[model samples]
Target: MKTQKNFRPFVAAIAAALLGGALAGCAPLLVGGAAVGTALMVTDRRTSGAQIDDEAIELRSASRLREAFGDRAHINVNSYNRQVLLTGEVPSEAAKQQAEQIVGRVDNVRGIVNELAVMAPTTLPQRSGDTLITGKVRASFVDASDLQANAFRVVTERGSVYLMGRVSQREADRATSIARQIAGVQRVVRIFEVVDATDLRQLAPVSTGTPATVAPAPAPAPAAAPAGGAVVTPVR
Candidate 1:
């Protein structure tokens, strides 16, 4: 329960570690008493090792992306349990496919949700709006007593909201509905690794949460993504 007060990991993730000192507020498990990283691991569905790997995956894939596209693309690489979700803008279709191909080569990456749009990078105002929308969505999750805010990871890009995490089918639908109600959300995407209720209980036996995490969603069709889940990723 102590860690609940510091439940803003989404902000850190969405900002792609660029929040710097701002993230320090939630990074510590104490103020928060425990190691901040340790605190997150306690509640995260991914094992501590997976959490670490996710970080590495993001860093490695991002470095590759930057090398491949430089200032031409605006990509945000988010790795949750080693399933990387790529969001942002690129100049061409070739750039988009190249981005996915580059990320797919990263070590430990089991799959990818390539949500990169073939367009120019968004302006600061638009990105700032996306940040605010992300904040509002996160606040809504916290306000929802039925859900564990930290159980979800949110990404808002150009009004579209993405949800990601390991959760139950009921949690997925509930979380989706919650996100869709947010005023500025253009759409809600589900990149959830939906688990059986029995398995969810096994992960957190005392958890009574009714909603899950956010990943970029589709507006009209399923992505060409491989659509893998937590089960096949093979980790603790």
Candidate 2:
């Protein structure tokens, strides 16, 4: 009976693996849809309009890429605050440039960072390993006390990690350090739009009844006397 119990667990694991494989194709769509819905309701730094634009940029870019490259390339389009990061494999340098050009034309794309390697497409197993590495890196960020984990986006291709977001220099550096410490991460790339902490503060909406700081106007130059005018000064 003990032997049978152990065998049953193994059988259950095998069945679970099979089920996962069967559903693998729908996983990204489901996860991405859920994340987008949740993010809209959360405290993300991006304004709701900017978030919507970023999503539109990603979708448009993907559609354009499909029309241009079809199955000849493996491209992953990630847009954060309208800055797009392109990662994956293309067949040639020409194709790489073409891909970037295509994405650049997408409306609302403020910038593009093309990190597509000029190589053959990676196998499914290799892609799965990269996904695992990305998950580990993301988990580490969540565990980090100093980092706002959602302030960064993590993408892993092969063994290289790509980080994207609008963040202060400190946050970007901290995130890069965390990703580098993960095993199987051979490289870390920063595609962040680095901003000052003050900039972030300025972007935040002022709370009710909070006074806004205004610069003092320069003292009005003493009223210029007419060419030969009276020297009497106005009373203060």
Candidate 3:
């Protein structure tokens, strides 16, 4: 009877150990899934529109990148999910390399994919307002074309517009005019490299990607202000 009692205790210990090992194996997967879900939720809550939010972030990052390079004369920035894609013409390979370096240094960037053309700098205003104009024109293109819509990225820095992706020159030209027509648009910049217009696809948002279905992560409270006013970019 004492042996039987001791056996029962050993069995219980073995069971516990197995259970612990199983949970340990699942822990990393669970943690990873939670983190990804949290990030997506945070991204969704922070922006009013996903595409618009992406464009704004891209524009802002592009501006910062150009400034950082100190050669804002050329270059356009497009952002999708923290990945920045630069497309446009630069005067030299050195300049092209510099643009990549500058964009990589920006905070929150997952990666930089530069498609900047190395050629004579085309006449385009690389100003903030110009980039805005470019975005407006791209929006018009989306409204008019039967294309997947999100397949194209439009970026304007100054008055120059850079269109990136596998788009026809006709499509790019149309996009350019759209930007030029917008008010406060000084000049229209075109840095589009035309290619086969096919093979573009847009990823459908997850079935549960809807705002209400996913709960946003709770943001920490803001820190106390320093002795002097300091400027900080909002996460959104």
Candidate 4:
């Protein structure tokens, strides 16, 4: 049960992000004079295999959620390296917990970070503002010389920015510092998988344009993320 430190009362997301249950799917990666769009298979840290497993996990979880709750919830599922992070809204605490449980049962899901808020879903304007905030944070990441824009995945709910990725402690701290300073951001929630050089080999290989027509993947192996688990940075 996590909470936004100083988040405002309202928030929202882009309609396109609604697909695959990944709220705000991938934010517009606005880098130096270029917008590389959202899906960055080539540069992503997750192995091409893990990335696909994440997508399946999200879709399966979303489908089950829809069957179980329907319009009763507005939940977003984001999985990185087989770890699923739940965000957005649910009608009650019970619904929230239930949502997490349902996703936990999905195939290939190795971990769950439950960040679902217990309340009503966000309105259109709030979602729009969230989209705007995500863009700002993304641009800030790109503008910072020390940061690689795609290394962090940004998801904004209301005015709270949820950053998900595999990064080092310094990168995490630097990204957190930048996110908390944004104009519309009232809180920064970091869901980073902190790792060092030795941890590199444990990750999935870089994406190599594997076709969707490729054969179904085997079950996801145990996560190689460090033993401390997801670094839950204090919401600032």
| Number of the top-ranking candidate, with TM-score as the measure | 1
Runs in model 1 lying further than 4 Å from the true structure: 1-36, 204-236
Q: How does candidate 3 score on lDDT?
A: 0.42
- TM-score per model over all chains: 0.74, 0.70, 0.35, 0.72
Candidate 2 residues 12-47, lDDT tens each? 534433333321111221111113556433656666
Scanning candidate 2 in windows of ten residues, the lowest lDDT window is 25-34
* C-alpha RMSD (angstroms) for model 2: 17.8
Candidate 3 minimal-lDDT segment of 10 residues:
25-34
lDDT of each: 0.64, 0.62, 0.42, 0.63
**Tens digit of lDDT per residue, candidate 4, span 146-208?**
998777777777687777777776777789888878778866666666667456446534322
TM-score attained by model 4: 0.72
Look at candidate 1 and tell me the lDDT of residue 84: 72
After superposition on all C-alphas, the RMSD of every candidate to the true structure, in Å, is: 9.8, 17.8, 23.6, 11.7
Q: What is the C-alpha local distance difference test score of candidate 1? A: 0.64
State residue 158's C-alpha deviation in candidate 1, in Å: 0.8
Stretches > 4 Å off in candidate 3: 1-60, 69-72, 124-236
